[model samples]
Target: MMKLDFKNRIALYYLMATSVISILAFVFIYFMVKDTMYDSLDHSLSYEARKHLSEIAVVADTIYFTHKKEWEETEHREVQINPVFLQLMDTEGQIMDKSPNLKEDHLVMNHAFSGDTHYNTQLKDRPIRQTQIDIKQEGTVKGYIVAAIPIESSLMVLSNLSRTLLGLFPLTMVMLFLISRYLAGKSIRPISAIIHTTGRITKNNLGERVPLPTQKDELYDLSTSINGLLNRIEEALEREKQFTSDASHELRTPLSTLRGTLEILVRKERNISEYEENIRKSLVEVDRMSEIVEQLLFLARNGQASDPSLQQTVALAVLVDEVLSRQHKAIKAKQLRISMESNSWGNFEVPYYYGSVILENILGNAIKYSHMDGRVVIELNGDPAGCYCLVTDQGVGIKAEDLDHIYYPFFRSDYLKHKQIKGLGLGLSIARKAALAIGAKITIDSELGNWTAVRVSFDQKVS
Candidate 1:
C-alpha cells in the first residue's frame, strides 16, 4: 500500500464524503424538476380538453361540436411546439374526432383509464402526457374525451439539466479537493515545524528544543511531550559522559601507582625484605582497582530491573551480623563501640545481593568514618508492612552542602578528603543503586563536626 501524507489523506476522505452527498442532491433536484414539468403539461392538456368538450352538444345519443368556428381556430389546430391533441370517443371505444395536429395518428383510448386519470404513453415517436374522462348526457354514458400534450420540450429541459449537473460534478470536486488540501496543510503546519526542529537535535546539540505553539491544542501537547523526552535524553547523555570521565580517572590512579612502584624497585638492587614491601604495596593498588571494577559492574547490573534470582526472605539481624563481621577489622582498629537494637521479626523480602550490598556499604562507611571509641549504633525494626535499619556513626561528619550529593558516584566530602579516608567514594553510590533496585529508600542526615546518620528502609510486602 502506498502511504499518503496527512494533508492528502484528509482531503481525499473529505472529497469522498462530499461526492456522495452531491450525487444524491443532484438526483433529487433532477426528479423534482421533471415532476414539475409534467404537472405543467398535464394542466395545459386538461384546459385544452375542457375547452373543446364545452363546445360539444349531445342529442339523442349523438355528440357533435356546437361551435365549428372554435374548432377551426389556428391556435387550437397547431401541431408543433407544445401542442395539445384532443379526441372524442363513443361508447364502443371508438375515436369520433381528433385534433388536426395529430393528423392520422389518432389518440388511442386506454381501457385502463376510467375518469380524470393522467398517465404517459408514446405519440408519433415522441413522449406525451395524457388524461381521459367520460362524458354523460341524461344520466347515461354518451362518449369519452381524451386530452394529451407532447412532452418533448419538458423532457429536453430535464435532459439538459441532468447533463449540466453531471458535467459540473467533477469540476466542483476538483476545486473542493484543492481547497481542502490547502486548509489541511495550514492546520498541520505545527507538526512540520516540530519535525524540522527535532531533526537538528543530536547528542552534541541536546540543548535545542522544539518551538511550542501559542494555542494549547493536541499539537502543543505533542510538542511539549517530545521536548520532555529530549530533556531526559540530554540528562542521560550528560551522566554517561561524567561516568566515563570518573571511571577513567579512578582506573588511571591505580595504574599510575603500580607503574611508579615498579619503576622505583627496578632503579636499585634492594634486599628481599624491602622488595617484598614494595610488591605488597603494588598488590594493594591492584586490589583497589579490582574493587572499583566490581562496583562499576554491580551498578550497571542494578540499573536495569532487579535480578529475581537474588530475591529471598532475608533476616535483617543475620544480614547485619555478616556485614559487621566483614568490617570488624576496621571497627577494632578505630576502637568504635557498636550497639544493636532490633525487633524479633526483622525479616524483609528483597533481593539477597541487593540487601547484602546495601548493608555492607552502610556498615563499612560507618566503621571507616568513626573516631576512636565513638559509638556506632545499628537499629532494626519490622512490622507486617516492612522493615527498616538505621546506622548512626559519630565521625567527621559531612558538611551540610555535601549531604545531598553523597549518593552520586565518586562524590567524596571535603571532610573525607582531608581525613584521608580509605575509600573510593563509591560505597554509598552502590548502596543507593541496590536500594532503588529493591524498591527501598535510603536517606542521610549529617551535621558537620557532629555525627552522620544513614537510614535504609525495606518493604516486606513487595515481591
Candidate 2:
C-alpha cells in the first residue's frame, strides 16, 4: 500500500468531501432542468388543444370546424422546427381530422383517459407529449380533440447538460485538491521547522530551541513544550559534566598522596616503628578515599526514586542526638560549646537511609567548620505547618555569592581554601540530594566570618 504524507492526506479528504457535494448538486441541477424542459412541452401541447377545440362548431347532431382553412396552417403542418399535431374525433371513436404535420401518424385516442389529462406516448416512432380535451354541447358529449408535440429538442438540451456536468466533475475535483494541498502545506510549515531544529540538537548541543509561531494555537503550545524539554535536558547534561570533572579531580588527589607515601616507605629499609608510621599514613589516605567513594555511591542512590518500604517514623530529636554523638570526637577536639533545644512535637516519617545521610551531613559540617571554642546550637521542633530541624554553627562562614552554589558537588568556598579544614566538598551536595528525595526542604543562611544556619523542614504529613 502506498502511504500518503500529511499534506496529501488533507487534500485527499477534502477532495472526497467535495466530490460528494458536487455529485448531489449535479443530480439536483439535472432534475430541475429536465422538469423545466418537460413543463414547456406540456404547455405548448395544451395551447394547441385549446386552439383546435375553439375552431370546431357543433350544430344539431353534427360537429365540424368553424374555420377549416385556419386549421390547415403551415405552423400546424410543418415538422421542420417544433411542430404541433392536432386531431378531432366523435364520441363513437370514428376517424377524425388531424394536423398535416402528423400525416398518416394520427394521435391515438385513449378511452382509458376520460378527463382533460395530458400524458406521454410515441407518435410515428418518435417521443411526443399528448393530451385529450372533450368538446361538449350543453353538457352533452359532442366529440374529442387531441393535441401532441415532439420532444427531441427538449431531450437534446437535457442530454447536453448531463454531458457537461459529467465532464467537469473530475476537473473541478483536481483543482480543489491542488488548492487544499497548498493551504494545508502552509498551515503545517511550522512543524517542519520544529523537526529540523530538533534534529540538529544533541546532548552536546542542546541549546537549540524550536521557533515559536506568532499565533497562540496548538502548534505554538507544542513548540513551547519542546523548548521546555530541551531546557531540562541541557541543564541535566551540564550537571553531569561538572560532576564527572569534579569526581576526577577529587579521586586523583587521594591516589597521588597514597602513591607518594608508599614510594617513600619502600625507598629504604626502615625500622618497624617507621614502617608502622608510614603504613598508618597510607591507611588514612585510603580511608579518606573510601569515605569519598561511599559518599559518591550514596549520592548516586539518592538520584533514584525513593522506596516506600524504607520509610519509617523517626523521633527527629533523637536522630539529631545520634548524629551529634557520631561527631563527638570532632566537637571535643575543637573544644566547641554545644547547645540543644529539643521541642519536637511530632515524629517525621522518611526513608531511614535518606534521613540519616541528611542529618549527618548537616551536623557533621556544623562540627567540622566551627572554630575552636565556638558555640554550636541545634533545635528540633514541629509546628502546625511542618517539622523543622535547625543547626547553627559559629564557623568560618560562606560568602554571599558562594551560598547559591554551596549544594553543587565539590564546590568548596574560597574562604576555606588555605585553611587546615579537612573536607571533600560532597557533604552539602549529599545532604541536599537526600533532603530532596524525601520531600524535604533545606535552606542555608550564612554570612562571612559570622555564623551559618542550616534548616531542614519536613512536609506536614511527615511532621
Candidate 3:
C-alpha cells in the first residue's frame, strides 16, 4: 500500500532477488556439511562393526567375542566424548553382549531392517549415528552386531552453522539494499538536474536551457528534447511580443488620424461641402482600422482551426481571376497592364476561404507595389506532380536582405523609403498563413528596384 521512489524500489527489488539466492545457498551449505559429518560417522561405525565381528565366535546359537581386548578400548569404556557402543542380539531379539559405555541403555535392534544399514537413533537421550551387521557362522544366521557413535559434536557444528547463516541473512540484505539504493540514485542524477533546471525556468527567463549530460543515454536524449522544446517556446513568445507591438502601432495610427480629423471638423462651423469632405476623410481612416482588425482576426481564425472538411475543389484559374478582379481598382490606379498565362490544369482541392485569402493578398501586393504602366503577369501551371500559381510584377522590388522577414506580420521592406505605398504590411503574412493552412507553399524572389515575383505551389490534387 505504501509507495516507494525509484531509488528505493530498485534497491528493494535487488534485495529480494539476493535474499532468495542467499537463503538457498545457505541451506545448501548447511545440508552439505551435515551430510559430510553423517557420512564420516557411518563409515566409522561400519569399521568398528567389522572389527568386532571378526573377533566374535558363534557356536550353535551362542555368540561371544573371542578377544576381550576389543571391549578394553577407551571409546567402548567411556560414555561421553566420542564414545563407541557395541551390542549383540540373537534371532530371538535377546541381547547377548554389550560394551560398558552402554551399561544401562541398550541399542534397540530394528527387526524391520536386516543386514548392514545406517540410521539415526537415541542412546540415553543423546543423538548418535548407528549401523547393524549380521554375525554368521558357516553361512548360517546367528546374531546382529550393532555399532554406534555419539553425534553430539556433529550436531553442534551444524547448529552453529545454521545460526550463523540465519544471522547474516538480514545483515546481508540491509547492506545490499543500501548499496543498490546508492547506485540507483547515481544513475538518475541527470533527471534530478533536469527537474531543478526546468523548475527555475519561467517566462522572464525563456532563453535558459537545461544542461545536457555528457553520456548519450536515455537521460541525455531527454535533456536534448527538453532543450528543443524550450527553444520553440522562446521563439514563439518572441514572435507574440513582436506581433502585439506591431498590431498596437498599426491600429493606433488610424485611430489617431480619425480622432484628429473629427476634432478639426467639430472645432469650426463648415458648409455641407467641407463637412462632407471631412466626414469622408474620417470614414477612410475608420475603414483602414477596420481592415487591419479584420486581417488580424482572419490570421487568428486560420491559425486556430484547420479542419479538413473546409477544403473543397476550386479551379486555380478561376480563383486567380477573382482575386485579380478584386484588385482591379488598385491596378487601375497604378495603370499597370495585367497578363494571364495558364497551362492545362484541373481544379485543386484546398480550403477555398484560405485559398482566396492567399491569392487576394499576393495579388494586392503585386498591384500595390508595381510602377505605373508596368506589366503584372499571372501564370497558372500544373502537371501530375503538383500545381503552382506565379504572380510577377514590375514593382519597387524588395531588397535582398529584407526578403527573409517579409512573412512577419507588419514587416515591410524599406517602409521609410516607400512611405507612399499604402498598406499595413500584413498582406504577405496573412497570405503565408493562409497558404500553410491550405497545404500550399509560397516562395518569393525579387531584385531591388527591378521586379518581384511570388509563387504558391499546391500538392497534386486534380479532378
Predicted model with the maximum lDDT: 3
| Winner of 2 and 3 under lDDT | 3
Misplaced by over 4 Å in model 2 are: 35-104, 108-121, 124-126, 130-147, 265-283, 293-358, 371-375, 380-388, 399-405, 414-418, 432-441, 447-450, 457-463
- The pairs that clash in candidate 3 are none
Question: Per-model C-alpha lDDT, please?
Answer: 0.83, 0.82, 0.84
Better of 2 and 3 by TM-score: 3
Full candidate order by lDDT, most accurate first? 3, 1, 2
Q: In model 3, which runs have C-alpha deviations exceeding 4 angstroms?
A: 1-17, 28-60, 63-86, 97-105, 110-119, 131-145, 265-280, 294-357, 371-374, 380-387, 414-420, 432-441, 448-450, 457-463
- C-alpha lDDT of residue 8 in model 1: 97
* Per-residue lDDT of candidate 3, residues 1-463 (tens digit): 5799988988888888989999999999999998898888888889999988888888777787788886788887877667889998897889988888888889988777777789888887888888899887778778889888888888899999999999989999889999999998999889899999999999999888999999999999999999999987886776667557667988888888888988998898989998899899989988898898788766655252347566555788888887788888888888889999886662555456778888888888888899999999988887667888889999899999999999888889999988988888899989887776656889999999989999889876422
- Candidate 3 structure, TM-score to reference: 0.76
Residue 151's lDDT within candidate 3 is 84
Error of 3 at 381 (Å): 4.5
Give the RMSD in angstroms, all C-alphas superposed, for model 3: 4.8
